[model samples]
Target chain A: MFPFRVPGAAPIRPHGRAADEVGRLRRPFAVVVYLQSRDPAHVKAVERRTMDKPTHLIEFETMLLGRHLQLSAPRLRRNNQSLDRSAYTLLSRIRMEGPMSIGQLSEAFGLDASTLNRQTAAMLRAGLVERIPDPEGGIARKFRITEEGGRGLDAERSANISGLEKVMAAWEPEEVAAFAAYLKRLNTDIENLDGRPWPRP
Target chain B: MFPFRVPGAAPIRPHGRAADEVGRLRRPFAVVVYLQSRDPAHVKAVERRTMDKPTHLIEFETMLLGRHLQLSAPRLRRNNQSLDRSAYTLLSRIRMEGPMSIGQLSEAFGLDASTLNRQTAAMLRAGLVERIPDPEGGIARKFRITEEGGRGLDAERSANISGLEKVMAAWEPEEVAAFAAYLKRLNTDIENLDGRPWPRP
Candidate 1:
């Protein structure tokens, strides 16, 4: 799923739950008898139709997911653990990759320099991050996560995990792990295509 | 995954990909043999430790996924076919469940009446939806998709599908279907928990 594999990254394999879901959805629709004919055109048409389906479903489900996030995220914020999403993500990036200048953040996140400047300024005002002279003595200042920032990110992350745990309460551990792996893969591929790979722990 | 299954909803089975990834993550660390000994304390300790892991990964990756969406969604808007996301989703809901009043949308999405009012008002201005007297002659006016809205939704949806196709270009059909199923299940569960229960087509 990732363009460059981590040296010892875990491998994700296909599982049966998805097969069962897909199979059940298909069974009520039609019974397919594979064509024994050697006609390439007929085979190609069938392949094309099959290929179109999953992608379509993925597109629709993701749209709904965005809606789900819209609804759930606000509810999550009623907890004192709430950290605005951009701030949380920015803190996470700094936590993972250490302090970085706005320019570096812009490059890593594909954001405009102005946007990063505004975002970092907000982080500074919120005490989530503080500016420091470059550790390597570069002219540009870098933003570093403060202890407060770390606590806030950790707290918000814990809340998020708790929410997911509630959602997946009935899932088997293997199912939870597999779904996570798939999400990681999907994000990695998106990062890969955008040429802005996010660092993983 | 859902509190209530649709009359004939497909069943999602747990598949191997997740197990493989989880197993690999466990390897290079330690191996455990299930103790035949009847010590409940040891068994409980092992179970607790095992339970804590994958949930953490899922939480972190989901946060990262949010970051990716922030980065990618704007780029997606550059297309002429672009429809604002809320507008697309609103049109889609109306398309699926038929035109609905502000109260119904608020209930279904858990949004404040003021928020849905503002959203529908904007959607009205954009010509993506129109106000109609409730078909049942109810006093509350409902929003219905315009033909233009339908066209915009379809165009944006196709673009979304194309983008996902690029992301999953190397994925097997089964993998794509499974991931979609996972997403569907996840969203359904979230909706169920929220008591929103988004209609599925």
Candidate 2:
């Protein structure tokens, strides 16, 4: 049902060999487009190349796309973007997996302890999460999602999921099920590689 | 070939209406999944819906997907999401037809001149663009894309186009051509409405 169009502007001309080499960097769009192009074998070849050079994916994402996407950070932070996602992720984890130690949360996300502390500090400030004295008293505090956090997470979840379902109304039940299954696996695979335990909801 | 595999994890308990509603909010992973699943027609709908609810899209993106993307304001000042697609129109105009004043840029984008001025100010600092002396000696300055900016733009274009090319490799050529055509129309429509003359080059 998608109506495709050619981009009207002039294609960026590759200036030389450097451009050609740099242009081959892995992009998420390339994966999607190749799937649409219906050349799974070519995609398999490209995927093999991508797997062989993990650094290209890292470099392309970090050096280029990451740079451009991130340029908006300061302006975005002053708005709600900074506040919501972390808050939601923290709360989601808490809701799904009971109370967690600050260290546990830190390890789960592979974030520095200090960064986790700082992030949780905000949650504590908002009363979206609470810091409790550890009975073990080992210099670590236990954190739990609060009712406020639950309420906020619920609202956010409701809004986001509703939109997706409406958009997917045209899809067959089997298609939706398949996509959802893939999504969960992808999420799990990503987390597993990062060494995070699966959430137990 | 996407090696389709069944998830080892438990079936994701459908959150019923609540989860679907919440999915509409456009978090990064969710957006990737949602947008990726969509056909070009569906994408146009999503983009239209996103633009129609500009405040929502801005809030949704700013709060949800934008942060994890970890994009900085300065970085975004250089480039916004290609996912938005329409954003490319302004950049395209600047590259093809600029050396235009802030007022002109604002007029072309149909945004508040002050907002466009703010955007250009960041571009100026990043040296992605520059402000030249207005030959007419007005208080306003004329802006043009810098060489570095052009390089950055080209890099992003290559990333996105190449990325899509890979993703849809499994689709037929006609399917690929169709979506490309729609994208071209959408880009042109935005530029035409936004007040920039189409660039010959």
Candidate 3:
């Protein structure tokens, strides 16, 4: 679905969970479609439409992930770098799926083998992850989250929750709950679109 | 607040009015409390905690502004590149106060004149805004929204609405109304934080 390929990046694998969520959302399931005649203008149009419509924004953010770094900006400025979705996806997977092989990571993210190599290279340089020889095979490699990565993830999670807390400081509990429910659904839809199974239906 | 910057092009600005609308939904109010701590990690930690909450994701997107391709990954691609929140602040001013002078933009965004010059230079190069020689004071330049800038704003608005629509596709009219009301209040709170006068309040 992505037009340009990041040489060393992997596509995030959706699995059945995401698929199920998307299915529930698109009940009678219309075939997924894209605008065929695409140019900078068309892409811009799509972006405009996505931003204007809340539903569209949710879908686009969940799928394309527009603002993953909003919470982490200040901290990231030390290095003057922000983690994009590709790397974030890897972090999320490692956090969610535990340790896995390079091949598995590649499949999960739909990234080419080489892309994973480059991404992993960066992650390794950052000490976010570590590589160990594969137990299954001598030549193959397996990656596991490092202590630093775990700490970073936890920090990110805490920051995320804290950020939410401040934003809703004046919000009623009911309002927060309603929005949370919507967020939950949005997350589910994103997972489904990524080919993961939905929680419901 | 980010652990690492995304290495690559800057985040894409929202394509049009839709993007502007989306930006509204993406955040709520935040108190810009100055930090006494000069430590980068400490500042980032505080910033992340204050901005990373799940509910605040929308707001974080705009504030962090990685989604618009203005600050996040785009700035980090090249080493030694620095990003200040001034341009984004200027964009916010334009959105809140409508068109004004570079001086006005500078004051509203809390930026120095030289900084605005540098920012406007980059902005003009990107074609997101235009330099219209100020009519009131011909000696000064008044930056105005270009057609491309308008389109970008529209794109953001559309993307935002699209996200909401996805969530609301199954909701009843009343549910939509309820959500809209809540959203309106939320927007008001955010505007208050930004010191902008709200129409309803």
Q: Each candidate's lDDT (Cα)?
A: 0.72, 0.48, 0.48
- Segments in model 3 whose C-alpha atoms lie over 4 Å from true places: A1-89, A100-120, A135-140, A194-201, B1-97, B100-123, B135-140, B155-168, B177-201
> What are the runs in model 2 whose C-alpha is more than 4 Å off?
A1-83, A135-137, A197-200, B1-68, B71-123, B132-144, B152-201
Local accuracy of candidate 2 as per-residue lDDT tens digits, B1-201: 112222442212132323233244433333343335435566555444432322222223323222333322222223353322223334556787757886786655545777777677767776777878887787777887788778767766655444333333444443333333332332343334334434544
Candidate scoring better on TM-score of 2 and 3: 3
Would you give me the overall lDDT of model 1? 0.72
Task: Report the lDDT of model 1 for residue B115.
Answer: 87
Positional deviation of A68 in candidate 1, in angstroms?
A: 2.3
Q: Which candidate is the best by DockQ?
A: 1
**lDDT by residue for model 2 (A70-136), tens:** 3322221223323355676677777777678888877766567888888888899988888777656
Q: Model 1: how far is B1 from its true place, Å? A: 29
TM-score of chain A of each: 0.76, 0.58, 0.55
